[model samples]
Target chain A: MQYAERILDAIDMETFILARDEGEAKGFMGRFLADLGFTDHDIVFLEQVGPGVRVRARAYIHRPGGSYGWLAEGDDNGG
Target chain B: MVAEKKKILLVPLDPVHDMGLKLIRKALDDKGHSTVLLPPGMEPYEVVERILDEVEIDFVLVSRTLGYRVGELLARFVDLVEVSGLRDRVTLVVGGMAVRPELAAEMGFDAGFGPGTTPGEVVAFIEDRPFAYGGRAEASEGGKRDLTHGFSYVYRKKEIQKRLAAIAGDIMGWAANKTSPGVERARLRFQALNKGEKYREEFLEEYLDYCDELVVLSYKRKQLPDQTRFLAQDELHFLKQYQNWEGRSKAARSGIRKPDVFIQYGTGCPLMDIMHIKVCEAWGADGLVHFDPSGGARTEGLLEGYLAHGEDGTLLTWENLRLIKNFLAPNTLWQVRAHRGLNTPETVVLAGELGADLTKINMAYASLGAGMDPARITIDGVEAIRWAAHYDLPFDVVTNEELSGVPAHKAFAGMLIIAHLALQLGGRPILQPLFCRSPEVMIYGQMRDNYIDYNAAKILALQQIIDAPLWPGAPIGFLTHTEDRVQSSLTTALHASLARSLGVEAISIASSDEAYAGGPIAAASRVDTLRATHEAFRFFGRAGIQPTPRAREWSKELIAGISKVLKDVANSGSFVQSLYRGLLGGPEDGAYPGRVGRDTLLRKEKGKDV
Candidate 1:
């Protein structure tokens, strides 16, 4: 969980999901990322190839102009 | 200096994989180091015996692809050498797949090299000299290049030149006495910036008078636009701290270097843009283009803040640009684009004052495709281009109108007129022809056969028209991309390779998320294209991609079509009228002359708004 704080902006996960259609594949991926507790997420890429789908999805660990986990106030101590 | 000749040994531990060692031995032999390469499948004790029996072996180099039990196997060899009493005199080194120097040291070896280690690197290790890895020499010395350097701007097609000259003269005469809100804002901003503190407030008061009420409210009432917020203090503090790291990345330039690659970054937020810019620079982006919000273009003025919008492009603001400018790598070319915006003049002023390396300007494209008033943009664009020259900032005359369904020839005609006008104003202009599967191409089947010939034809035609630099995109492979990262990256890389093959000065490439309209572009998508382009350059290495004879035919056709469009515009007698009439691009072609800022021109002589 602490490692998540070091991410620069967002974390992307590229994977494959076996599903009937592109929509179903995307649905499965959304649930998969949600299960892992990523809310601000979107499927960057999804394609129904063969019986499965090739998917690349992302969850924003930190958005720009928001409080950054990477720049978490550290030993420098809340300047 | 030739390294001191020493006896070296090379041992390929694998039974049948000695090709790497053979190459290393040849390099070592050429370097005057006597290398005794032991055969593969040699037992550790046999190699130890050979080292012990050999006359004072100075080095025992072993090559083994780390596999199952390979680490333990190499450790036993080091132990055998130690027990034979030659370990003190002999240097033992291991190299092959998956071998890191740390792993080798842990395995009781002196050093190790992973895959992609060159034979020259191995020789340098044997010679005890430093080896520059990953072509760091080129990256460190890879200085910034002027995209418009060494172009004479001579027109090879004199007939087209005549038509262009007429168009340029027509535009200049029309723009001479005219001004717009954009122009006045730029002038006031320029005075406000250049003048002392005494006159700054006076100029800003006059500047706000020309801006939209929303803009004036932002400056005076400190009210921000919808979905726009200023960056928090701690975020900026972290950003300021982020500015400390040096640009130690240039892996993007792994090989051939004709066309410098640029990446456009506008993550709606300046902080995110900064992160993307740094990631792109590390990945070897030679330049960065600041993509501002489309809403900023329709609005009559630019805001002043570290504004962050939850949108597609970053908001154009002085504070946002200044922050981005400050953190740019020393050699990284920075471009602040105002090509299609209502704040064209002020954007140029900001880009110039902030030390941006480049800017983008194109009146015809702005008026027709991007929905800006023809007359207003001409006046504003003329002023912007003039200031771009004054700031010594070279700009690209982009033909993105082609993507709006305007055919390449018509869009190119518009581009040439604006480019010539800019050149006459003393600003350097690089012609940016969209290397895309445009609506025109899709409808006309100009690229149905291949993505080659037509794209190559654009370059070829431009080269024929003028001896100026061609930078082939705002992002090459625009519509050819799928959401698939592999497909998107390959198309971009292929287009880049094509641009490289044609010897262009620069190109803008898209992140693989170019087709993913679902959300904002991801950082990983940017990396995919960059890494792909790197491999593409390394793959071709001074070789060229040959387009079929159809390229020449298309080149001739494009040249003729551009000529016909220019002649038509010239005969129309008024360039602005031509845009209104859609001589450059019309309703049929999906390019509608915009009405924003219409009837808003100010005549200096008449002292009234038109």
Candidate 2:
């Protein structure tokens, strides 16, 4: 069992970035996720409020038809 | 009751915030504990001096709102208490905004309470008893509901009812003399299940005659279709293992009534479907709809076995359905759709035999939108409804032709005809109108102002026509969702709330992946909408979304249009001919009569009963 295996499907990270518009918010989200070592990430939502942009980004930890790490036996780290 | 009265000291360290301490003191007093309250703006030394001067203090409760240097101040207070040798004599507790239990422990306090801590919890802590917060026990008592309960299924509009009766009578009359391959398979399948081995073999031999070549080959050669495989022993073992795993229980509904929520699950594999079903069930879904492969409907016969397919829809089979059914919660309502394709009747029979609570059937959508011959679907759909009635399963007449560019009026006409036919046969049929941004709405700009008016009109018009249980379904918010989880979930929740406001019986909701086509819907996405719907329900407790006056206007137009379509259908002489002529939905409306099972009707031999 691995730590990532505990994630049922995907991890969504939402935050408010002090960006000027939707494009800048998306750029900041990409950099933020990339800084956190997330390569396969997508911007799920982005809306510009008066002060900043609220963004939701998702990274798929596991998908159907793939080998689910949680299903594996004898993995002590799996929760 | 406490063994003895315990003296407690409540200290408000903040200059302006003493609400938390005051509430705790009141609860302590109610619990029959002797308590002393220290005034606000007391220095750390003054609190220590008060505790020292108090006679045999049992607990010292301190409250502070988080601010600049608040942590250091709390630390200094704890250090002063320790230095005064009073830390070991009393149970020191700290709580306020931004104060966590971990931080309290780090600051040398025995316990901490953060924001939203209730007085009951603090009292329980003082009395050293476990506190049950929230309504978990009460939430577990929300049992399964029969959405159709208490509805009389009466028609309010006598003219529309009369027209529907005429159309239904014509349909039943035409179908009485007709039988398609789908109908024959259903009959033989039922007989085969009830009789002995010899009879089953004989029935199957005759059954192969009506099957497609691919089906016949699969039966004879024991080979499955492409991208499909029978479930292995290990997979079955895994299923049993998953079912037996601990902590699986019914989800709490958080007290929302009207519009019981259902999730549609068809992940190509029964194992995956069962997993998804469990996830949805544990996340407050009241029911589930099984989606079979589209190709399975077009094929002449159904495959048999515990099979897994690596595709879009699960293969409809007795073993597969039973396998999935075994894992469902006792109260979870299950619906296996038999609406379209070649296996409508047989699917209904199988679903009934497997103990499904509900089934779906619609002649118009099956023929027009789902690519089944109109004549064939009419015969098969009639038989399916009968089987559904026989099994005491409530079937829903879904108007999915609205998805194929047909206007709501034409689709409603088709749905009402089937619903009336079901009523005629003594069957309980739920009316399922698509709560979507349908092609009709898109083209006509009916939803340009808002999504409420047209959808509200659909319900209003249906209520004017009949009083059957209305379940807006087949995944509401269809064609209005995107790959964005938040947007998709918000749209689904909004639709669900609207359905709730309209007092609909039930609603079928999509996951956050409703618009995502890249892969199977992720399990987490299912929870997204469930949580959102729960929030929406909470936000509008007994309140409602107000649709504009246009809703009433559109409702009148829809009713008139439905009446016109029914008149046309009734005057077409034969209901089957009316379908062929597109009176209910024409090719111009993007509803083409399907070609599969075309000319496959078997005429009854002379002097032989059908």
C-alpha TM-score for every candidate: 0.83, 0.77
lDDT (tens digit, per residue) of candidate 1 on B116-180: 67898788888888764343345447667888889999999999999999999999888778888
Cα lDDT computed for each candidate against the true fold: 0.85, 0.83
What TM-score would chain B receive for each of the candidates shown?
0.91, 0.83
- lDDT score for residue B565 of model 1: 96
lDDT of 1 at B417: 94
lDDT (Cα, tens digit) per residue for candidate 2, span B1-610: 5446789999999897788888888998987899998889899999999988989999999999867899999999999999999888999999988676656887889998876577878888888876643323233366566777898988899999999889888888787777878888998899887785779669879999889988888788988888989889888886786574333232323445567788999999998888777667656687899998898888999888888888888999888999999998776789999998899999989988888999999988888789888888888999999999999889888988899888999999999999999999988999999998998888899999999999999999999888889999889888889999889999998998898899998899999999988998877688788868877776877789999999999999999999999999888878888878988888798888888888888764431333
Candidate 1: C-alpha RMSD after superposition: 10.8
Write down the lDDT that model 2 would get.
Answer: 0.83
C-alpha RMSD by candidate, in order: 10.8, 10.6
